[model samples]
Target chain A: MIPLGYYIGLSAILFTIGVVGVLTLRNAIVIFMSVELMLNSVNLSLIAFSAYSGNPAGQILVFFVIAVAAAESAVGLAIIIALFRNKLTVNIDEVNILKW
Target chain B: MNLEQIAFLILAVAAIASAILMITRRNPVTSALFLVFNFFIIAVLYLFLRAQFIAIIQITVYAGAIMVLFLFVIMLLNLGDDKLLKWKLNSAKTISVLLGIALLVEVSYFVLHFTSTEGMSPNAESIGTVESIGKVLYLNYLFPFEVTSVLLLAAIVGAIFLAKKKFE
Candidate 1:
């Protein structure tokens, strides 16, 4: 049996990548995709802990998280579409209308 | 180590590498594709953890459904590379990358040094099966399960409302 630390470490690295993507990337869709990556990494750690503890609750929570992520991405993408329709661009840096 | 450890290492490497590639790709479509690959690897990792139900859900919901939505948005927007290239490496980006690396190092330190006294239940192997998950989900988690349906419905309505052509 592998130590639980390995999974946790992997999850942490993935999460950091997501954070860097969100921080540095300007494409709105890519940013959203990075957010999804972050969520998936969190789910990984949750399942790892659940398995390590022999508790099903973490897995159940992952189920809820997945459902929420689906809903969030649907709504988020729709909002992005609306923004694109109004601004003619999906780049976050260019979409700033409230700056002034 | 054994097969499980080896599988974990391979899947973990694949997942992390794909994620980095996904973030660094210039094209949104390519990035989304890499994200799909990352999701699939994570699903396989779930299988390694014996969470078969979550593994399947991760594949179907994340890799399949969510990625399709992302691709559709990417195609619909049709953003040009010139527009995406507006942002360059600035101070904020450098600091963010530094912070991210620091966070990773700190978390790894904790994870590597931490110890737990609780032992896994002997029946841990069976907990991840569909039947077992279904029991806990429907019995103890019935309320949250129903709430999830409601949330999905709300999201659907909200999305349609947002994306619909303004009739003004």
Candidate 2:
């Protein structure tokens, strides 16, 4: 069996990458994708813990995470679309104004 | 390392590569595709970890639905050839990258130092199956499950309200 540390290490690396993406990327949609990446990495760690511990709790948490991620994405994308329609720009840099 | 560890090695390499590709791509569509590929790799990794049900849901929910939604949003926006836009790596980018690296190092140090030597539990192999998971989820997590439905409904309403052409 592979060591749990390996999985957690991988998850950490992936999470770092996602953080970099969110910090550097200007596109809102791309930023959203990066957030999803971070979430997935966290899920990896959770599953690894659950599998090693033989606890179903972690798996259930991942399930809820996935479900909430789904709902969050649906609403998040809609918000992005709405923001796009109003401002005509998806670049996070330019959409600075809160009120028109 | 046996066959499974070797497989995990290869998949980890591939997953990291695809994840990097996903972020580096200028076009959001390409990024979405790479993210989908990364999700598939993670699903396989789940299978190797003995998480059978989670692996299936990882593929179905993440690679299947969320990514398709991302692709749709990308296409609808038509933010074509984002490379043409000037994307300079300012001090913020540098700081962020530095911070990310630092975070990775910190987490890795902890993981390496605190390697759990405990043996796997007896039911560890079968614990990830749908049958076992369902028993716990339906019994213990039932309230949360119902709340999740309410949360989803609220998300649906909120999405429609936000996206409506003219909100009254």
Candidate 3:
């Protein structure tokens, strides 16, 4: 069996990549994708721990996470589409009237 | 390294590469496609972890359902051209990258330090089976499972309301 550290490290790296993407990428859609990436990394860690601890709880948790992610994606993408409809752009920087 | 180790290495590399590609692509469609590829690789990783049910869910739900929604929105918005997109090679970008690397280092250090070398549980195989999972899910976690259905309903209604062209 591979060391548990490997999976955790991989998840960390992926999570960081997702964070960087969210930070740097300006497109709302890509930002949403980055969010999904982070969520997936969390899933990886959950399953990793679940397998190592011989517990199915983590697996069940991941199932809920996936369900939540599905709901989030549907709602989030709709919001993006609505924002696109009104603002005519999905570039996040441009949507920052709230920032000022 | 054994065959399993080798397989893990390959999958890890592929997953990282695709994630990077997904994040960096200028075209949203391309990024979505790379994300799909990354999901497939992660599903294989889940399989290796003995989470057979989660692996299938990752494929069907994430790669199948969610990605299709993403692709649909991308195409509907006609966002193909990104020439005038707001991205630039500047200070904010550089600092975010540095912070991300710093976080990666911190997490990896903690993981290596804290993780026990004791690997896979002997009973991991049995617990990961669909029947065992269903037993626990239905008997123990029944309430939360039902809650997800309600949550899904709310999301569907909310999405339709938000996406509609105008209110009557």
Most accurate candidate by DockQ: 3
On residues A1-100, what C-alpha lDDT tens digit does candidate 2 reach at each position?
6888889989999999999999888989989999999999999999988988888899999999999999999999999999888888888888877746
Give a tens-digit lDDT track for model 3, residues B1-168.
899999999999999999999988889999999999999999999999998989999999999999999999999999985876646789999999999999988897898797587979999988888998999999999999999999999999999999986533
lDDT, ranked from best to worst: 3, 2, 1
Full-model lDDT, candidate 2: 0.89
Query: B17-103 in candidate 1: lDDT tens per residue?
Result: 899988887878888889999998998888878899999999999989999998988888876465455557899899999999998
TM-score of chain A of each: 0.97, 0.96, 0.98
For each candidate, the alpha-carbon lDDT, in order, equals 0.88, 0.89, 0.93
lDDT of 2 by residue, B1-168 (tens): 689779888999999999999888888888899999999999988887788999999999999999999998889889886753345788988898899889888888898897686655668788888898899999999999999999999999998988886522
Give the range where candidate 1 chain B is weakest over 10 consecutive residues by summed lDDT: B79-88
Q: What TM-score is obtained by chain A of candidate 2?
A: 0.96
Clashing pairs in 3: none
Best by lDDT: 3
Report the lDDT of model 3 for residue B86: 48
What's the chain B TM-score of candidate 3? Answer: 0.95
Steric collisions counted per model? 0, 0, 0
At residue A21, what lDDT does model 2 achieve? 93
Stretches of candidate 2 exceeding 4 Å from the true structure: B83-86
